[model samples]
Target: MRKIASAFLALLLATLLGTAANPNPGYARVISAGHVEGVLPDGSAYVMDVPTNWNGTVLLYSHGYVPDGASNPARNAPSEAVRTALLDAGYAQIGSAYPETGWVVEGAMPAQLGTLNEFQARFGVARRTIAWGTSMGGMITTGFAERHGRFFDGTIAMCGLEQGSVANWNNALDTLFAIRTLLAPGSTAPLVRLPDQATAIASAAELTAALDVAQTSPQGRARIALAAALRNTPAWTNPAQPEPDANDHDTAQRNQFGALRQFLQTGLTWRQEAEAHASGNMSWNTGVDYARMLANSAIRKQVEAHYRQSGLSLRDDLAALAAAPRITADPAAVAYMIRNISFTGGLTTPMMSIHTTGDPQVPVQTEQAYAEAVTDAGRSRLLRQAYVHRAGHCTFTAGEMLAAVRTLEHRISTGQWPDTGPLTLNRLAEEWDPAATHDYVTYSPGPYPRPFHLHR
Candidate 1:
C-alpha cells in the first residue's frame, strides 16, 4: 500500500480553486469557506485555513509518505472533518505539499520550515505555533520539534515512525528475510535493493502465496506465527473491524496473516526508499539471532500457544532461520540514511505522540524506542505518548485528533502535562463526535525489535 495521507478533497478542490502567484515567488488561492491555498515555485504546495474567529495560533501539519508515482499532493489535514474542527476551534491550519515524497525527510525538513516562515511573512507572526504530523509526517514533526524547537511552542504526532528510518527499515527487513527463508525455502525473491517495481512485485507475490498456504494448517500457522513474532508484527491488521479475540486460534492465524500480507504487499518497497536516498541497500541482519529474537518478542506467548496448538516443534523452524545466511548493509548507505533523516532524541519542546497499538505499517514500538531515547536524554518531561487499540496506520478520527491537539496545547500553555490517561483521552475523543469511530484502548507498546542507536 502507498503510505500517503488520506487524500484530501483538496486535490479535487484545487482544480476548481483558482490561485495566483505573488511577488514572494509563491501563489495563493482563496477557496470557499474563506480558506486560502497556494503553491510555491519549488513544486511545494500549501494551504492556510483561517476562520473568521482567528485565535492567533497556527497548527502546521506534516503528512505521511507519498510513493514514487504519486501524481497528487498531500493535504494540510487528513480529512475535511479535521480541517473544519481545527478552524472551528479558532486555530489556523497550514501545510506544505513538499518538493518530493517517499521518505524524503531531507526535503521535507526545509520545506516545512519554509512553510512556517512563508506563513509568518504572509500573515503576521502568530502568538503560538504548534507542529503536527501523521505517519512519516509524524517522524518529520518529531524531527522538527527536536531540530527547530525554538520555532514552535508544542508538537503533536500521530501514527508516526518515531523509531527513525534505519531501525524502521531494518525491522521490515527482518520479517521479509524470515518469510523468504522459512516459508519459501529456496525460492528467489528480491530481499534488498530491488532493481525495479516489477521485480519487487514478483517477489512479494511469491512470498504472499507462500503465506497463504501457510495459513491453512496449524503447523504452517505456527511457523508463520514464529516468523511474525521475530519482528513483533501485530496480529491485528484491519482498522475497519474490531480486534480479533486473543484466544481464537483461527482468528489469531488469520490476523497474523494480515500482517504478513501487508509486509508482502508494501514491506518490500522499503528497498526503493532506502535506495533512493542511500543510492544502495542500507539494511542488514548479519548479527541477528533468530532464537534470541523470538524469545524476546512481545508476541512470544502467542507464538508458544500457536506452536502448541500445531503439535509441531517451533525449535526446528527457529534453527533453520539461525542457520540461514544474513543480509549486510553498505556502510556508506547506512551513514547516508542516518545523516540525512534520523533523529537524535534531542527534544527541547513539549511533544505529544499517538499511535494505534496494532499498527502494521509503523508499529507502536517506534513510540517506545523514541520514549526511551527522550528519557535517556533527560527530556522525559517534554514527551508524552498515547496508543489507540486500532489496527491500521494513521486511522485516527477527527475527534481523537482534536483531543490530542487540545492535550498538547494545554501542556504548552500551562508548563505541565495534563491528565492524558487513556480513560480521560478516550472520553475526550468520544465527546468530539460520535459519528467518527474512535478506538482508544489502554495499550502499552512493547520495545522495538530494532531501535535506532543515537550513537554510531
Candidate 2:
C-alpha cells in the first residue's frame, strides 16, 4: 500500500509539472496558489494563477522594459502587490516573458497574444479578460487594442508611453541633446548613432556625473532648467519628497536637475539600443524651435529665474541653441518607427489609462497625445483616463490600481462610465485599501514637446 501511494504521488507531480501547457514543456509545475507555469512555442515563458473560487475573469499582464543583461523573463506582472491582490480576489492571472527584452514592442504584442491563447488552452477561456500593462507594456497594450481589441474585454495602461515610439524617442533625444549641447558640448555622450552598447552605457553614466557637477553651479543649473523646459520635464522628481514649493527657484532647479539625472540616466543610453532596433536614427532636432518651446513651457519663469540668478544671458543661450547644428533622422529609421506601429486611437476595447502627474520620464503629456489619437479616430467615447497625484513613473499603489481597474470593469459591465472624477475614485480606492493613499486628482496635461506619427 505504501509503495502504491508513493508511485501515485510521483505521477501527480509529473502531471502537474509536465503537463502545464501544450506539448508539456516538462519544467512547468503547479505552484502555490494553484498556479500553472510553462513555456510557449515562441520560447516565451508563461504563468497563470487561478484562485480556489475562480471568478470567471483573467487579467493578462504585460510588463515594462527589462535591460538586456537583466532579462529574467521568469514572470510578467506590473507589480507584486497587484498580482497577489488580484489573484486573492479570485481573478485568474496570466502573463508571458517576451522572447526578447529592452524596448521590444514587436515581440511583446504577439507574445501577449500567445500567452492568452496558452491560458485558454490550459484553463479554458474565462468569461471575461482584461489586459493590463505598465510603461512599455502599456504601449504594447495600446497596440493590442488597435490590432487585437476583440480578444479582450478591456485594457488598463498604467504609466504607458502610448504616444508612439517615434514621438516618444524623439522627446527623450531632445532632452539628452539639449544636455549635451548646453552643458557638455561634444562631450562624447553619443546622442544618436551610438557606436556600440558599451559606449552607450558609459555615456549615460558620464552624463549623470556631469549633471551632478552642473548642479553645484548657477550656470549649470540654469542650462539644466532650459533643457528641462525644452524637454517638458516636470520640476518635481523625488516621490519621497513633497513637490518643491512654488517660487522656490533654487529648489525647483534642484528638482529639475534631479529629474534630468533620475530619468535620463537610463534614457540617455537607450538611443543606441533604439537605433539598433530602428535600423537607423529615428530622432531629429533639425527644425525644433528652442525659443518657442521655452516660451510655451509651464516652467518658463523658473528657467528665467535660474538664468537671472546665474547672471547668465538667457537670450544668448537661446541664440546658441538656434545656431547649434541639429541632429537629423534617417528617413528609413523614421519609416520603421512609423510603419512598425502607431496608435490610431482605434481601441475597440474600453480603455483606461492611469498615470502619475509628476513623471519626468514618461511625462503625463503622453496621455494628452493618446487622447488626441482617440479623438481623431472618432472613438473618443471608448476611452477614459485618470491620474494619480504622485511623482515617478508607474509608481502606483495597488489600491489606486484596483480602483481604476474596478472603474474600467464597471464601465465594461454596465456600458457606462462611472463617476471617474478623482475624488470619487480616490474615495472608492481608499475604501478598498486605506493604508495605500489614493490621490487621484483632476488634472490636464499640456502639449507633448515632440510628436511624430503616420498611420496608414
Candidate 3:
C-alpha cells in the first residue's frame, strides 16, 4: 500500500511538470496580417488586426496615440512582435486604430471588441479574451476594464494612467506647464549666450512666437525646436538631458519625445472629436467624448487658462522662428511629458502589471502608485506587479518579456497564479548600497517634490 501511494505521488509530479512544459499547443505557426476594419455601433469604420490561429484567447490591443488617424490603424511593429510571441505561446491577438487616430477609448474599445466578437462568432470558438495596451493605450484599457470587466478575463496595463478626473487633468496640466516653463523668457538664456540683452529678448520672442504658430500648424516644426531646446537647456532645477542630434538622439526622441507627441496629439484630437460629437455632431462616433467628459469636467477650461498664463503666444512664436534662417520647426517631433496621474480601483479581473525601475519616461513611482491603489481598494489579491532594472521606456530584454508572457499565459490557462517574487531594483550598487547603510536624495523643481533617488 505504501509503494502504491509513492508511485501515485511520483506520477502526479511528472504530470504537473509536463503540464508546465507543454501547457498549450498550436501556439506555433502564428502569422502577422493587417488592415482589417471593424465597425462601431454607429457603422463608422475603425481598423484592427488578428494574429492567425484563433487560439480561443483573444487580446484586444489598444495602441498608443499617433498624430494622424491614419497612423493609428497602421500595424504597430511592437504589437506584431508581441503577436508572434503570443502565437508561440498559443494565444490570438487583435488591436484597433482608435477612432480618427485619436484617444477615443470609449468608441474604439467597443469597435475593437465588437470586431473580435464577430470574429469569434464567425469562427465558432468559445475562447477567453484579454485587454492590453501600453502608455495611453494602457490608460484606455484600464478605463475599459473598469467599466466592462465582464467582457474580459484579465488585463495587462503597462505604464497605464490609472487615476482619473482631477488627477488626470492636473497631471496633463503640470506637464504642459513644465514645457511652458522650460520655454519662459529667462529659460533658454543660460543654454545659449547672446551678444546682448536685445539678442536674448529677440531669441525669447522668436521662440515664443514660433510655438504659437506650431500650435495651429498641421505640421509641428516650432514644437520640435522647442523640444530640442528643452532637451538641450539645463535651466530648470531638475534638468533632463538635452535632445541629441542624430545618433544619441535615438533613445531621447525616438522613445521619449516620440511617445509624448503621439500621446498628446492623439489625446487632443480624440477630445475634440468627442466634444464635437457630443454637441450634436453625431455623424461620427462620439463615444470618446463621452468618456473624456466623464473623466474630467474642467479639462478644457484648465488647459485654456494655463495656455493664457504661459503668455508664449503660439502665432507670434511661429513667425519669429520662421524668420530665423537656421531654425525650423518639425511638428512631427514635439516631445510630451507624462503627467496627470490617475487610477480607477475595484477591478474585477486579475491583473499583472510590470514596469522598469529605471524608466525615464514613466517613472517607477507611477507603477507603485497603481499597485498601491489596487491594494488600497481591497483588490490586492487580484493584482500583481513586476519591476525590471532596465532604463528607457518599457525597455525590458526580450527574454525577460518572454518569461512574463509565459507566466501570464499559464495563469490564464490553468487558473494558477504565477509567483512574482519581491521587486528588485536593477544594478542595485549603482543606485543603492545594501551594506553601506547610507541615505541619498534627489530633487526636482517645485510641484515635483518626490525624491527621484534616495539611496544612490
- Taking all chains together, the TM-score of candidate 2 against the true structure is 0.90
25-144 per-residue lDDT for model 2 (tens digits): 434666775688877555568888888989888888888888777855656567787778777788888888876667667666666776776677677768888888888888888887
lDDT by residue (221-264, candidate 3, tens digit) is 33333343222211111123433433332233334444344334
Which candidate do you rate higher for TM-score, 1 or 3? 1
Colliding pairs, model 1 = none
- TM-score (C-alpha, index-matched) for candidate 3: 0.52
lDDT of each: 0.79, 0.79, 0.43
Model 1 vs. true fold: TM: 0.90
Which segments of candidate 2 are over 4 A away from where they belong?
Answer: 1-27, 186-188
Model 1 alpha-carbon drift over 4 Å, by segment: 1-25, 31-34, 434-439
The count of residue-pair clashes in candidate 2 stands at 0
C-alpha root-mean-square deviation, each candidate: 6.4, 7.3, 16.9
For model 2, name the residue pairs that clash: none
